[model samples]
Target: MVTNLRADAARNRERVLEVARAEVAEGNVSLQLNEIARKAGVGVGTVYRHFPTPRALLEAVVGKELATMVQLTEQASQMQDIRAAMEFLLRRTLDLQLCTSGGLAEVICAIEDADERTTHAKSEMRRLADHLLERARAAGVIRPEITGEDVRNLMAGLERAVELDPDRADVYVSVLIRGLSG
Candidate 1:
């Protein structure tokens, strides 16, 4: 009896987390606990039992976002054109960051010390960015002086721009692309 109860509780918690992630992704971070429970097909008490606070739920959603970014980076690595891949990643990343409340900066700040998945994702993102930058430089598509850090900083700037004024994100992204292209 105890084992079955524990298993059910675990399943319910996972369901709640999954639903919460979707909600956050859709810019619904302020969704009430009861609403989440209803969406997850669980009781309000179940959500409270799993995530005691709104911050905890947001933290979990941010973790999911991080994992998604890592996956996107890995996918970008498979693209044939380095510059195209970089552009795609930048656009996709900006879209995701803008979907959330405070953008990537806030999500990153929420995480204290990332878990293994987040850490691995960060490393993989860095490696792919470096590889893409090297290829772009070699192909003369991007300025030779540009480094991976520069690309990251540019994305950070984009995040801030999106956070401040989402309507102008496209303009900022265009400038970033133009500046990178040789």
Candidate 2:
């Protein structure tokens, strides 16, 4: 996305993104534009020009993570062991969510307001996840009632739980995987 901007504008945008990424990684999702502007040494107008709202900035920050999730799902869908694929996808997705401190989850949860690029990434993620779920069901590895949306929301919930109790992340993942299995 930054490829189109002028040199200085690209630098400013990168600075803003760096600051915003740090804030989100630290669980400070407020992402106030003025604060980001001050921290990035850019003017408020620069911040606005680059990202009009906190969600826009957040989408920019977590865009790569969303893409990674889609890639992971695609890879998972290809594996022969459907159950192992599901566990791998869930674990890796949860790891990404935890690394971002739930920023990806926040963006995904607000799909209605997402930009076109983010929406497309989310849709692809959903489609791939549903494909994985269907394969798991056919293999009799996952519960018949569980849908892709349930998996996504459950992963988000696991991320929140891990945020609150970091030490119990492994236990939480194990329980979630077990609960989802047939």
Top of the candidates by TM-score: 2
* Candidate 1 lDDT over residue span 2-31, tens digit each: 144578898997898888778876667665
- Candidate 2 per-residue C-alpha lDDT over 81-179 given as tens digits, one digit per residue, 9 for 90 to 100: 898898899889989998888788888777475478999888888888888899899888889999877887898899999889999988999999889
Please, what is the TM-score per model? 0.64, 0.94
Model 2 misplaced stretches (Cα beyond 4 Å): none
- Residue 23 Cα positional deviation in candidate 1, in Å, after optimal superposition: 11
> Each model's C-alpha lDDT?
0.73, 0.89
- Deviation (Å) of 50 in candidate 1: 7.6
Error (Å) of candidate 2 at residue 43 is 1.1
